[model samples]
Target: MRILVVEDDAGIALGLRTNLQQRGYAVDVCASLASAWAALSSEPFDLVLLDLGLADGDGGDLLLRLRQARAAAPGALPDPLTPVLIMTARDQVADRISGLNLGADDYLVKPFDLDELEARMRALLRRAAGRAHPLLVHGELVVDPAARTVLRAGEAVELAPREFALLLLLLESRGRVLSRQQLEARLYNWQDAVGSNAVEVHVHHLRRKLGEGLIQTLRGVGYFIPREDGA
Candidate 1:
């Protein structure tokens, strides 16, 4: 799954990112609310790890803006099922209650264990899925998560292994910026340098077979899959 870590502290953000990466998640780290907003605007993500204290703005306002963004969209791209896990140093009951009221799916106080955080995220994802997996859908596409096959509009779409891998990467990230270097690394080994046109080639094929505007290119940065309306 894709997870966004909105935190200002380098240590905490790195720790969370490393831990989550080890747990088979693709993580994007941002230090300020503005960066976080940029990330959110460009990509789709499965979950968010939001910190109350950010360098650019308050987490409360950020949360409100996120909700407004979703509401403004035609069908709320990320949908209400997308989880937002709040991480804060404040542990007061009022703070927890207020965050929950504001739409946070779960809360974690500072000085917590990474295992606990992972456990909480697993629980949230399970609940979000209605306790099921396989046959993942995004917009008009249906992905057989188990078979690694893709179908769009009821027609089977042939995808290269690399294309399928990249698509799954984007789906797992479903609402976050994925740097080209990051995507390239997934396709190439550590010792091999990814060719300039390799990722573009795979993406081009995927798009031609899938549909135009299926995967959006973020100029100067990377790629993202916009959340579908009502998803």
Candidate 2:
């Protein structure tokens, strides 16, 4: 998934960007509130990791603006229900309450373990996908997004990080076709040097590992995984 990290702490931002990328997520970091707002207005992010304290403006203010924009005109923003998780040094009861009331989906105090942070992120992503359980079933394939494991016919299947991400995205949009541009935007961050056929290469890798017919192409349109009825 693509995530926007709004933080000013250079060390913390670098650590988060590195860790999230290693875990198979496309992440973009913004140091100030202005940059964050600009980023949000430009692209679609599956989730946002926001810091409360900002040098230019308060993160709460940005959160309020986002929610208000969604409420007033949902189409103006990339997603009306874009999830936000606040990570801040504020640990007071009121601060937490205020953040939650301002549209933060989840809150985590600073000085947190990366493991726990990843777990929470998984939970939030699952919730956003409307999945009560972590496992995703497609025919004989069972995918554990949290564990980053895949089982086909009860046998383990190992996939590269990019391949796994592409599979997950295809599964999530089972009946819909995703253009190569959409896939590229969701799979790669700004820093990654992408080849012209990067998405095609990833899709080719997935087809080889999973199955030939698992992912279908539209010739001139895009790619999609067919529904059980083959629609």
Candidate 3:
């Protein structure tokens, strides 16, 4: 999914952007609240990874602004329950409660692993998607989350853990546009589970096995799987 990453630390921001990108997310980084607001205004993002201590202002204010904007322009917005994952150095119980109260979907303490962040993100999105471990089906392509089976054209398509996770995300939202951030969230627990070109590598292999048209890449956005009728 499209993600806006609001962070001030250059190294941390770069690391996040790079890692998320490698995992098949379209990530935009902003070092300050002002830029965060601008990015939020300019384009539609499925989720956000916001750092509280931004250079321009508190991330809470940014969250408030987003809520206010959504309220003001309800019809213009895409996803009403846009997930926001808070990133903060404060790990106190009160701090976590405060962020959640301020409309943050979840919070992560600093020095946390990217994998953990991704898992939390997946949980948030899964809630927004209104399903927990939902099964995905597209024609002969069936992905059973519980069974961990992938079948294309009625033939079983073998996938590694990461590959299965990636396919699950695509099939979960079949016919919907899923930016890389959303996919990255599925791989949160397994950092070394993939290489730099992991998403691309997996997608290539998936297309080869499932058929070239199964997963279509949206230029400058991400990937998707259309329903059988559309195909």
Candidate 4:
């Protein structure tokens, strides 16, 4: 999934970006609330890792803005329902309550465990996708996002990071069509060097490894994974 990390500390931001990227997540960093707002105003992000103490403004202001943007014209603003996880040094009850009241989906104090953060992230993403289970299951294809493993026809399938990301995204949006642009946006970050046919190559690889009918194409529109019952 694509993540926007709003943090001011250079060391913390770099560490988060590097670690999350290694876990197959596309991450973008914004050092100040202004930059975070700019990025949010222009693009779509699956989740936000917000830090309360930004250089320019309080992260809660950004959170409130994001939540209040639900009335914008369709596609004109960022998704108001997009999950936000507040990561900050504030550990008091009032701070946690205030952030939650401002539409932060989850909160983690600084010096938290990376594993716990990832678990919380997974939970939020799963809830956003309307899934209750951590494992994504579509017929015989079982995907474990935490484990980064896929089981097809009762056998383990090895997929590259991009391929895995593409598969998970398709599964999450099971009946919905996602254009190449959408796939590319979620699969790669600004720092990655990507080829023109990167999504196509990864889709081909997924189909070959999993099954020919696993991912369906729309010729001109987009791609989608069929609903579980083949709808």
Candidate 5:
């Protein structure tokens, strides 16, 4: 999954980025609210790790802006229902309630355990994906998002990080087509040099590992996985 970390503390941001990356998540870190806004506006992040105290302004403002974008016209923000996890040193009850009221999925106080953060993130992601369980099943394919494991016909299938991410996205949007631009935004950050055929390469690898019929490409359009009725 792709996660954006908005933290002003250099140490905290570095730690978050490193730990999340090691856990097989694409992470982007920014110190100021302006940078965070730019990143959120440009990319389709699966989740956001926000710190209330930012260099430029309170993260609450950014959270409000995110909600506003979601309430705007269609396509105003990629993934309008994206989850936000607020992390800050403020541990007061009012602070937590305020953040949650502002539409944050979870609130984490500073000096928290990384394991706990990850667990909360997983819960939010599952909720956002409309998944009651960590395991997502479609036909003979079973994907354990938390474990980052895929099983087909009761057999395990190993996949690279990018490949796994791509499959997960497709699974989440099983009946809908995802355009190339949307896939690119979800798969890559601004700093990454995305090749013209990056998504195509990942899709090809996933198909080879899963099945050729798993992902269908629309001519001159996008890609999608057929629903159960094969519509």
Candidate 6:
């Protein structure tokens, strides 16, 4: 999972980035709301760790803007419904209520335990995806999205970043075909030069890593994972 950390305190931001990275999450840190806005406008993220007090402005404003953008159009914001967790020094009951009312998925005060923060993040992510657990099981294949790890028949499978992402997308959208264009858009950012064969290459790599019949191609349409029931 990818996360954006909006914090002005250098120590806190660095610690957050290091800890989250160690836990298998791709992280980006910014010291101000402006940089956070720019990052949000540019790339997609699975979640945001927002600090209320920033170098330039309050984080609540940014959260409001993000919620507003999500309400405007289908794709107005990257991951329009992306989960947000507020991490700040403010601990008052009203402050917590306000942040929650402003669309913050969860809130954590400073001096919080790293383990608790991680647990909260996982909970919010699972809730956003409408999943009851962090593990996604499809027959003999087990995927832990939070850990960014996959196991096939009790054996761990190592995959490149792109391959893992492709596998995750396919697993998440099982029973539905996803076109090359849609896959490229989700996997690559705007700056990436997506070659015509980019998706095919990744798909090939994934199939080799997993199995031949894992992901089925529908000729000119797209690719999909066969339903677990084999319907």
Q: Which candidate leads the pack in TM-score? A: 4
- TM-score per candidate: 0.58, 0.95, 0.67, 0.97, 0.93, 0.79
Ordered list by TM-score, greatest first: 4, 2, 5, 6, 3, 1
**Which candidate, 2 or 5, has the higher lDDT?**
2
Report the CA-based lDDT of candidate 6 relative to the real structure: 0.84
Please provide, for model 4 over 1-231, each residue's C-alpha lDDT reduced to its tens digit, 9 standing for 90 to 100. Answer: 899999999999999999999999999999988889889888788999999998888999999999998746755657789899999999999999999999999999999999999999999999998889889888899899999999988999999987899999999998888999888888788888989988889988998999899899999988999897777
Q: Where does model 4 exceed 4 Å of error?
A: 71-75
| Candidate 2 lDDT, 58-173, residue by residue in tens | 99999988887743464345465888999999999999999999999999999899999988888888888778887889998999988899998999999999889899888888
TM-score attained by model 2: 0.95
lDDT of 5 by residue, 44-84 (tens): 78999999988789999989888767436645554457799
Clashing pairs in 3: 1-179, 1-182, 24-180, 25-180, 25-181, 115-188
Q: List runs of model 5 lying over 4 Å from the truth.
A: 70-72, 78-80
Of candidates 4 and 2, the better by TM-score: 4
Stretches > 4 Å off in candidate 3:
71-80, 142-231
The candidate 2 region of ten consecutive residues with least summed lDDT is: 70-79
Query: What are the per-model numbers of colliding residue pairs?
Result: 8, 0, 6, 0, 0, 0
Can you write out model 3's per-residue Cα lDDT over 142-213, one digit (the tens) per residue? 676545688777788877766776776676677787666556544542223545666788888888877897
Sum up the clashes in candidate 2.
0
lDDT winner: 4
Q: On residues 1-231, what C-alpha lDDT tens digit does candidate 6 reach at each position?
A: 667889999998889988876665667888998989888887667789999998799999999998877435654554458799999999999999999999999999988999899999989877876779779999889998767788999999998877887787788778889899777766764334779999999999888988999999999999999889885
